[model samples]
Target chain A: MSSLPDRRLLESWQDPKAAPYVRIERLTKKFGDVYAVDDVSLNIFQGEFFSLLGSSGCGKSTLLRLLAGLEYPTSGRIHIDGVDVTDVPPYSRPVNMMFQSYALFPHMTVEQNIDFGLRQDRLPRRERAERIGEMLDLLKITPLRKRRPDQLSGGQRQRVALARSLAKHPKLLLLDEPLGALDKRLRENTQFELVNLQERLGTTFVTVTHDQEEAMTMSSRIAIMEAGQIMQIDTPTAIYEFPNCRFVAEFIGSVNLFEGKIVERQGDQVLIEAQFGGLMRMRSFQPHAIGTPVMVAIRPEKMRLCETPGGDGVNRLQGIVEDIAYLGDVSIYRIRTGSGLLAEMTLTNIQPRTEQALTWEQEAVIEWSPTSGVVLTE
Target chain B: MKRRSWPLLSILVFGYAFLYVPILLLILYSFNESRLVTVWSGFSLKWYGELLHNRQLLDAAWLSVRIAALNASVAVVLGTLAANALVRHGRFRGRTGLELLLTAPLVMPDVIIGLSLLLLFVTLQQTVGWPDGRGFSTITIAHITFSLAYVAVVVRSRLARMDVSLEEAAMDLGARPLTVYLRITLPLIAPALLSGWLLAFTLSLDDLVIASFVSGPGATTLPMVIYSSVRMGVSPQINALATLVVALVAVAVVIAGLSMRRR
Candidate 1:
């Protein structure tokens, strides 16, 4: 081999109007009787950072493995850049995967590991050497190029694995829990670096992670999976603020649910005779039949607290402070109403605005703006 | 220490002496001048000088070296493949049965293996016309079959203890399957392969029964020559050859030990 390819080699190879980056149709993986990745069809836009987010056993990793061509789908079609690749072996796919464990080749130094794919391509020796140098500089790991994986720290090993993966100049990159092995601070820092690097290189990344926060911060859009099915596919804010069901409502973030029956309905709002104690007025874009049982989902941060009922908002209820929790930046107050209502209020630490804090057993009023809550018809 | 530990230590020590004493005695008597067996007169290097002149023993020794070298290299490759399959691939239907069959050669008696292979060669000649007669070729095949079991055992344990995610990470990093095996898997288990080859070499060199059953008229391995010579009383030349064998073995063992320690 001559050498590794330089930056210009890869930059000049980029082509537009080539093909659809990846089109997955009804991809399903079955482990005996269990559907690990159910009949799922999705289109990955070119150069998009897509995330598969869910808890463990939700089959997010399985879907990613399918896309990486590590595991074949039982019955489905996979096309990469418009080529049918359902039966293509992982090595033949124009995709590379970064494992959750950040598997760096231990026997070789960092540079050799990154140069592995280029060597496989039988590239000219000069190009291989140049590409290796360029990747080392691009990944900011030139200083550690000669070190074995064991000598490098967790984050450095991750970067080496990434450099090696990207050195192949793959059209797609599959990240399996990329930041899971790092400390919290390192994870936060590396997440931004990964995003910026992906943007700079413009490789379509399909990341699989159980960390909701990491997905929220890194991905352009996330597929919220549950029990081998996607519950919602949207941006992080949309998934959090307007969950389509009770499961999505609770899984993504904390929600205060009031199970109630809608007794009155207006043009765009309704009055819910809550199962707890009072009537709650909620904004409903969803069609709700009167006298039908429903649930109102409200985030604690959206709720405002006071010692007296002075809200112009229609959804107001009086309750006694059952417990007061003083967190560092914010305080959480658990208030109880008649007929078993446990309402939570999160108060920001604005010292001069001492009006929000409450004492135990103190009677208080909790209110939320009508539009801040969602009404789940089911 | 436990009450059983003292007895265990003594047994191990005594076992070491039992194993070493004969080799030590053989080396000492290689210098004998009396010419009477077991009755040492004084020490001399006359037998060593005589051993340098024995062309038949020297040729057999050379043949033995060639056989061991070929067997070890072939066995290491085959054994590493078998070991990877047994470790990396999970249990499917008939896998347990395959494992049982794979390991049967390890504990089977050498005489049975020798006789069965001889029979197999005869059957192949009578039916298939391949390997028309048994000789060095058949002997090496027989040795490869039995020695491969030893090599596979070592490679298997090394592979089983290996972290599997290492290979997965390589694949995830854009390595083709064969490249992952060659670059990552082979390098990681290289120590195991080295020791396995060494083991197969020693076993082929030390073998007598199987080589005897399979050798043709002209194919005289060292152990076959030594076994035939042992029926006659002790010879000065045999002692000289034994001493040389002892020295070569000791040096090889020391090299192996040093390599293992460094690793």
Candidate 2:
């Protein structure tokens, strides 16, 4: 986790001179009439843990399969490490995939499963054994090397699948929901381990996942996809803090969106006359013309209990607390304002739960700073 | 524990008796000293000893075993290939027609199959001047033609139920298509192939009508010999042969069961 900050500084995508390791050019895959992966182009920098985040049926897995050469693009080309491989089959590509189902060979032991790829490359017996041993140790399954897939637990099978995929030391590894099959506790622990392994090996990883927290925790950059098109691609921090569009903002996490029109703009700030009856002064990275319809997206945790309710009504809202959900560390207060808009606010319980001040049906006032949220034009 | 109902117990006993009485009677009579199948005197191994020396029956039995082995081997190969095509190749051209044709023999009466194959062999001999006469080759070919359908059915169901990702994973790990099929797909579906081979062997061994129609004078199968002998009169020697067959099949089944359990 400490290495994350340093890895962020070495972000090759931020540098224009750094060439991409994988370049997909307008890749499109169609199964009959449905476009599984529509015309989409993306460049993944070397040694980066990139994630394709989306709900099911959003074409993320299809895109990953296209990269693995398991599913060829109906049109467009794929270039990996400066070589065209669109026509290459999965076996011939310099890429390996860890399927969502793990897909371990039930007939083979762990050692044999991991040894399969090295054997395919015609490696000598000694070298193959050495590589198998190295992989078993790396995944911490040395003792289970002689066990068949069905004899191992789910987590052990996952490790064996990971070891097998990494045996070849492919230039790029595609993972389709790599941690989707694990229990919740194991999934969280493996997420960090995966990131650390990626950094240590410096092998570019492209994983597809529907878990936003998993994506945010492990990915150096997250690509949000919807309906076979990428909605946003940026660092996890940027994707969370400053989503480029309404779809991206709502998709990543819970956000309270206020539909409004921009009535004033001064430098990097814009004043939007919100539909909830008050004006919202928000920081905007992009310029918005006056009278342009937009949305002010603010996360629930950013909203706080207003200290001085009557001082200024610019970013303040007075409402009745309609619902209070006590969630151990924090409490969610659903405030229904006079305009009949439900604004959700999350407050950390700094004190004991019994000493909390807010309650259901109580009149509460919430306010957010201008920089705490973003204004999206689309 | 619940008490067993008298009615259910009687029905169970009746079912068992109905199925096993004839077999039990035959086994008992096989050891009788008397030559009459229905009459019993003292227990003896004379019929078993006489069966060993019966030249015609021995020759027919050997011919039947050879034809069964050859038919099962050839059917398994062709049938497994057919199953692979139907399962792995997703909706290729003429798939429906091919599937229908493959299963047609399963429902076709043995008489129809025998007559049609006999006609086909005659026409082939007249037109191409091949298959010159019907005997061992003709009988084995006829058996394989019908046995293939049963083998295909068994293998196809197993192949369909298999996890397809195993093969895909192999290919992903850099195995070529042929290597993937050989290393991953074949090993996983081996139990199905074994069962299919055994099924075809039994079908070929049990066949009577088809063998009679296709076989010329010399290639008399065991079933044909047993049926002709029964037409004359029930022979104690045939009972001894039947008992041996049942024992061999039971042993084979036990071996297969044990091996499967170990896996």
Candidate 3:
């Protein structure tokens, strides 16, 4: 408490441009004997849309709570700008948390609920009215001002909640699965709306979600957490393309993994005799010995299927067609190799059902270029 | 096995008839012209006119109403506080025992509560010389002793049914605890608080045994006057008074029901 500089508090105190809008350093939280967040550190530049993506019970929400000052760290410090505010209470901190349940005041009208925080700060009557009006307009919930939370639809309540949280315009905005309560279609649309709003306000937004696609679509950078630790932190493309472990690769997207050993290395590309697929290769940044074991992660769409099948450059494997799935706009084929291993090949519809489709038990070939397969060393 | 419910309905109807027919009969007899009780000579308003002229009975009714109103106000305030303390505040030592003790008035016989309160007041007066005498104040104390139990039960149920997150959400949004309770919690539970108060008021109004025990010479209440009239033998005026009392209760029930329904 004495030496820690709280970044949010400091941002509220200083000019917003001078500091990263949110900073969390070595923040750890414990629930009973289980460490919920173990020494997590991150910095979000002002106006950046950051996301904490993880599986359930991965402590993503806990980390978000620490950032919002809803919960305190067991051991480290939080700084909003450059000042230490590790011990600052949530109300006094310059951050607002939108709860997953929306946590709207049920007895109040939409206008009164949005005005709750400003009224608590003893804002002048006229100024509070203007701010509330601006927020309702910004979220486009002006017509719902007189309705209670239960009367409005889920999307409407969600907008009212967003308006309420943005009423104060704190330097950092923490969203705890903001789109989770909406229906699927509404959630997708609200995600874009949320991104646009954050862009317009230029406020640092920290979102916590278990839905990987939501995180990927909205986040500038994602910190993938698992079991109280942040496994990797990178841009969405980097995380998807260059996962450090099988967990990150599998968690972020559907990837076909084949166990293999590095038989030869040519700079960044490694050639391997995969036990399951019989000769696979990948380009990996992590150095490996000539005989070291690794995992090859290939996305479904990346694997190419050929009827004639005479290719040898990077990751070419021979398999028989075990099954075909005709999904809309695309067809996925399960290719069974000589080793009886299944590799998935997803074909986007370039033609009708004839050219790109395969029958069960038909002999086929599944392959991809070297850059498509990613090596997961850990 | 599917059993017909008409038998159970028949029993309930018989039970209600057993309980209410005599009261209805008294209400009808209040309009009789005969001075003799139990004989319906003709429909008239003579006894009602006589009841209005009975100054002692009127004074006693006023005294009873005053006592019940005062006792109900005190009970509701004290009960609301106790209910909140019991439910919201965390556990402490003797909590289970305290809860049991709080329910003693509700389960204990009215005679016992009346006797114990009278004894406690007399002892306190003798020891501290503060009360000096027991009359209206004593009866009010007795009414509150029993009514507080009802108030606590009602308010505790309301608090239990309440969504506690409303308060926590208020605090998170920057309202202080006192402000949260005032602006959110009190309004949400107001319906319960009102019903609790009205129940306590009615209980105080209807009490006979406890009030009889606690009353001194000047504190004779309406029920005591009515009982004395009944003991003296049924009279036309007493039936008329009973009808008036039944009307008052009916009105109170209607108002209380309307209040609850509005909520």
Off by over 4 Å in 3: A1-19, A34-36, A262-264, A289-293, A306-314, A338-340, B1-26, B31-37, B41-48, B90-94, B115-119, B122-133, B142-146, B212-217, B234-263
Weakest 10 consecutive residues of candidate 3 chain A by summed lDDT: A1-10
lDDT of 3 at A237: 86
Candidate 1, B80-151: lDDT as tens digits:
878777888887677788678668888888899999988899899899997867777888898999888889
True lDDT of residue B160, candidate 2:
91
**Tens-place lDDT digits, model 2, residues A328-362:** 99999999999999999999999998898898899
Off by over 4 Å in 1: A1-21, A310-314, A317-322, A352-357, A361-363, B1-45, B84-97, B122-134, B159-185, B216-219, B227-240, B250-263
RMSD (Cα, Å) of model 2: 1.7
**lDDT per residue (tens digit) for residues A1-378 in model 1:** 333223343222133444556788888899999999898887777777899999999999999888877788888899988899888777777888888877777778998888877887789999999999989999999999999988999989899989888898988999999999999999999998888888788899999999999999998788999888888887788888988889888888789998999998887989898877667888887777889999899999998875456545357767899987788688888988865678888888787335654778988888887799798875
> Model 3 chain B, TM?
0.92
lDDT of candidate 3 over A6-77, digit per residue (tens) = 336443314455656566788889988999999888777777788999989999998987776667899998
Report how large a share of the reference interface contacts model 2 reproduces. Answer: 0.80
lDDT (tens digit, per residue) of candidate 2 on B80-169: 999889988899999999899898899999999999999999999999987989999999999999898888998898899888888888
Error of 1 at A373 (Å): 2.4
Which prediction has the highest TM-score against the true structure?
Answer: 2
Candidate 1, RMSD to the unseen true structure: 5.9
Answer with 2 or 3, whichever has the higher lDDT. Answer: 2
Q: What's each prediction's TM-score? A: 0.85, 0.97, 0.85
**Over 4 Å off in model 2, which ranges?**
A1-5, A8-10, B1-9, B255-263
The candidate with the higher TM-score, 2 or 3, is 2
